[model samples]
Target: MASSKDAYRRKINQNSDLGVMRHQVVSLSFIATPFWRKNGIGQRSPATCRFPKVLGTTKGVKRGLVLPLVATSSQEARSGVNASELPNRGADRLREAVTAREAAFLAVEQSLMQNATTSDVEGTNASTDSKMSRDSPNASHLSQKFLLSYLALWSEARKPSRAEYALAKIISFNAVRQRMLFDYVLQTNVLREREAMDSVPRRIKSDNLRLSVSQRALLHTALAQYAFMERVPVHTIVFSTVELAKTYYGQRFASFVNAILRNLARYGEKWMPELERRRPAEYIVRPLPFPEDNLNVRYSYPGVFVAKVANQLMNQERVVAFLEAGNLTPQIFFRIPCQFTDTAELRAALEIGLLVPWDGSRLSESAARPWNIYRVDLNCADVDGAGDLVIAANTDRVEWAHALPDTSAKDLFQKLLQKFIVQNVTQAEHIYDLCEQLRARWNQRRRLERVLDLCTAPGGKLTAVFEYLQKSGLGDLLTEYVGVDLNGQRLQMVHENIHKAPGMSKGRVFVGIGRGESFVEYQSGFVVQNADDRSIVPSFDLVIADVPCTNSGVLNRRPEARWRLSERDFATAIPRLISLQTSLLTRALRLSRHAVFYMTCSILEAEGSGLVRSVLEQFPEFELSWERLTYTDTAGRDGGYAALLWRHQEN
Candidate 1:
């Protein structure tokens, strides 16, 4: 029997397809195991378990023998075994082992498939749950990470400052206006597309999908570039986004971000046509079918505000033009000092255009007049100082007093003017004109012994008052000038601006830190009495209360203001602003001996006319002498409301 087995083993080993037999033996081990026997196969002995090892080995062949052995001689035949029959039995066992192995493999594959299916369903459920409760602790961490990572400078505690706006614009490719729109698309459109492709629901809120700060910022920039900016190439946008992600996030996150942006680039444009077709009447997409509705989205003006403006203007065409005008950056107008030499040369070099003189004679014809025809008269200076000079070339849009040309000339002119004429740059608005008019009118009545400028930070009105005093030949008569502001930084700015004037001495101008509401009265030309302590301060013949209000009129100059101002914001702000304005005006009335000029940069009736009406009703002693409300839509300058109030004193 041993000889017969040896002969069979030698025959198998000698065959080139022994490797195939070894594979069969290895697979049969799975069926021979006790675990398999418990399931279906019959229980085998320990000798049978060693069969696979025996087949695998080259040196030793002795092991559990499953094959039925046959003898070659007559003596072996009597035992029902033959050498030739043994080979056939071996072949039969090998075939049986292969069949058993295949059954085991099929069972394993089915079990694995079932387990995977169960796990996938569970994962899907968990993902759905995560999306539903996106404000979970984990999601909060993600939200915070998203905000901090992209917009490091932004915080919920404070509003975005000018410096922050500037920084955001630089990183986000000047897409500051489209920030909210971009976010809207990302949360609603982009996120939806991603969710459709992926089975795993993104951990995103249905209403407000929270992305990492970097992710949000990058998405906004990319979308803005892809949708609006045709000049910017797709690859450049992708590269910039990837680089930004890598800089803030790790390489792994960068790869993840890269995949998302690439997907956007591929499929983003296809949706444009559909979006346009499905766009709501109020909402506007690019390549506008209706130009009338475009300003609401294109200029980023709130729909409510746009409707309000349309109602106020009473003309949809005018409303569109006004909104369009507001989107443009206003021209920087400079007031040439009486003392600055080479006025003609500067005017010629700059190609400076003059503001239409406010004499009321050429009110209609001024819009048609050429730029060169308008003259700057230094000797007979009005509120605008002869005439205001636009630092850049004027545009053909005659609706604005000056629409600055978008050219290299504008850039070069701004640079030269800033370098050469440092402190002469003044915004040509109706408020400044009002300030100058107030100062001139008061000085004409009686020389100003002292002047008080309340809330006088950024110091434009105060500086104008000083310049007016100098130009009107009342510089000697003005003994002291006092500027008070609640903000310390603005008070410092007042001090700095005061120092710029050649005639203004250190002792002449005093910038103090105090709320306008606190200072109710003044005793002498050198003393002020508030709730705190009595301080030596200059009493005033004139008090200019340029109180803070909703900067609605100057929306054209301040692009971010449109987003910041809402109907709710105005509703809440107007009442508080009215209170503050009332308090400041009352205090100014108490302090001034001759006149008080109450001014606001708001076009709203509630902020200007309403506030003034309330004050007049409260104080019967004061009378309104002169009031002017310049509307930007009509006047082509920033709209403002100014009322000159004077007390009737017994002779």
Candidate 2:
């Protein structure tokens, strides 16, 4: 397994340096036609882009290069067109360029396939990155922006403009988010001609205009643009994608690229049913139940998830809202210490024009939200709260993350009043609520100070947990606070976050690396071991288990989680995930002296309510006192599940 740091570096190379081109892929660039014409390369063909007389047909290749003259919605009539004519070129040069580019394409095709398959499998926190996607966890915790940055670098375009980066980010996320639907569309219209789902994608003779996984990814990118970004011109989508194939793969692919994308436009776009930007994502995702093609693509989720929805929520409109919410861009929200009172100042610093209602207001939290958290809108969310941005007395700050970008006075809020963690309103609200509940008990039992924040990444919820506890007057009560995570580097962050807070005696507040199920309570502190301990270990007064899940509820924020997940595959994956969730909760109970906190960032019943019932059934001594499930809302908050479990029979 790649270390999280190594994985983090690999993702960096993919997006920034393309240093991993040898192992993954190398992209090449083709200047767009309009940009070329504007630069005095007017109308003459840029070295023979037409088909060879030897190929015997020009199915997709045209006399002109493929690019679009973009027009706004107001000028709807000029939305799209094919490439413009280019100058004829020497035959020898055409053939040579064709062979070299085609060969490059062939080399990277397999790597592209393998990389796409791994999109949802692993993650590591990419705190050092400065992109919008950095704050939101990348798939495997890096590279939600990986592929597009990857394409740009391999193509030797070097640094992309912020606009290019933003476009790539949106396309990359949409491709992953709606991969199933895109694949479904391609499979039905084009891929069925060759795709072999049971095994590796077999290559066809190059003469037949074969579709490689590289081409499939390109098509997916194009499709994502047409479906999600309303302003993108269809002809431009064609040109960009076809040029991608022509420049990187060779001219051999440009025609096929041209043909497939036009077909894509025909089916779900410009010429077909005419998908509208405001319409729900399900508009073009319809396939009949008889084909086993349920609305999984419409919802961009697994069939097992769709079935679980029917069993759990059981309401049509609510389900639609839930699905639609995950497809919209999630907002950037932060948690303020309950102690802060400078709302007017904070708002002035972070605001542009209108201040929307609190996220709590959506949850009917009109009172608690205004004081607990205030939403800050910035075009960039990856601002590291360094220097003047610090919001605390002794450098304690909340670090929150968001993947998408927003529009605002990017300069005015470049620095903020408080260094707070990037958090969802609903999530922060729930955590605050949980701490308040713990407050009553802590008031009675002053000795309940030992705390274990289990399975959290570095600085995750640990900082928030401390602040919430402080507000409840329980901050000074802690003698031992141990934050445990699977990643050592992230745990180091936990140490950095908690080590500075008021209660610091050596070894009293620290972090341990390894699974919570095997973490051992050591003398005055904690240590994480890979296996069972032979020696006795003490228990924590409260164990907060923010266990991992499928990230179903947060698909908008965690798009990578959706890939590698399918209706058929979820049957296997969900069970394994439930097993892990079960193990973490079961172990947390054993490790706790008083109560165990079980939480997941998932809306699936199998992982949320259902799995909890199953796990608790085995332990008759524990009872669920309270649990809250916040569904993903169109208002931009990520969904989460949090529950408090009490041990009735004392140890």
Candidate 3:
């Protein structure tokens, strides 16, 4: 029912309304926008603006030009408006203004330097000065002085160690604060090889030509005199000498080194790659058959052996993609202590680029204020694209559970159990049930006689055991609490913490520093030894043998372990496990009434049941007490841990 002209008018009004609303919203952002976004923003003026107060107050101001009433009265009234409307141009200009003292000092220095130097400054000219200068006596002398002074400075900057230049080049490249060119040189390894060649001693061989020679030259002829005179590689020495000569002397000196090096490279068959080309038969046109199934270039291992384990443990595709992603490129993270005036101020000053939250679980800012500000850590990673995995990297361990490929599910789950333990007490009963077969013995044994803690050093488990004993009031009942370790330093920890918490029975806690075989003399007390070591000790009663095996349980704990582990390691560990069991059982039968061998490794028959089988075969006196332990009865377990109790009856 609407007329065409009326519809057009409505459309125009709608568009005008939209335009006014859009402009109003955008206008709100102009004056109050963030300072960082203020760059390139143009100045805006109100329509029909009044003249400024300076112009209005002028004595010759025209009546028509100025606002109504008295010009003075309007000027006074419009002062606030003028002040508010004025550009903040002078605000930024204040930051650039140089102090009077500084300008005066710089003026004096400029005049003195220009007059005092004959042609050029001491450290300003030479190869770095790409600008061409007029040739004159004074200019040439000044250039020579500058070169000498610059070279002296360069020489002084060299590190003290002989190979320090090479090492420093690498270290400085890796350092976050260093120049990008240093990183490029390090990546190329140009300086590394140069330093190596420059380290050798030299002797003058040709007195007439005055060619300096190294010991290697004694084995070659005089044709190699110029090249063999120095320990440096012929090509490197020639190229470097030529480059330096061109910088200082002229192109002719560089040409001299080049011609000599070409001859040396031709004759130096012992050092350089051969460049001879033999002609093939011109008429031959027979096709060579290529085997389709041949693995001529396939089936070889990827990267290093250790890297293989890491790849297997981590989600390789996701990790690779994540590393390539700019988002994950080692973000800069800092652990700032709470000492600065405000954490925000310090963070602002220190933050040069993007910052990310720390990944470690243990990264907690201390409640202690000022000290906390100073004690923060800083880290950096670059961000790539969205396809890469967002790694929860705390130190070296990067866990990307969701990022792993579908094919890697089995390995992924297996490693997950190894990395985390059930901290919840409600979950512990189910976890404990899956760990050991001898449920009856664990339930019946109201009192524990002797406890063995194998692999007890670096004791997360040790602390738990001590706490368990303390809570149960079983610490007093423990006659001999033995902690075994191979590391001398870790043994020191066992010695210290065991005495402090849940004090063991008087004179019963024994700390063994050496390998398990070192305790072969004793049939009882406590013994700590590596499983592969010689088994000389007597049998134990309650053996707490936390045997060493493929650490598949802790893939998350050791990211590198996944790539390092192989079928060969699994195969190799079986025999070692048997040997360890033989050693421990031999000692256990003589010492304890029963043994409890605990391990973080899976309860695969190879390590747990397989070794138990070998122990039963060798010692007929011992029996697998089904009533005391019940580990194997359950199916489809989470941790894949199993326990078996071996009792040596009185024969």
Higher lDDT: candidate 2 or 3? 2
Report the alpha-carbon TM-score of model 3 versus the true structure: 0.32
Find the 10 residues in a row with the least total lDDT in model 1: 26-35
Candidate with maximal TM-score: 2
Number of the predicted model whose lDDT against the real structure is largest:
2
Instruction: Report how far residue 52 has shifted in candidate 2, in Å.
Output: 11
lDDT (CA) for every model shown?
0.44, 0.51, 0.30
In model 3, the number of clashes is 63
* Residue 112, candidate 3: alpha-carbon lDDT: 20
lDDT of 3 by residue, 553-634 (tens): 3221211222223344444533454455456544444444554544434323454555666766866766755311112111
| TM-score of every prediction relative to native | 0.54, 0.67, 0.32
Q: Which pairs clash inside model 1?
A: 70-81, 70-82, 71-81, 71-82, 71-83, 72-83, 146-212, 146-213, 147-213, 150-214
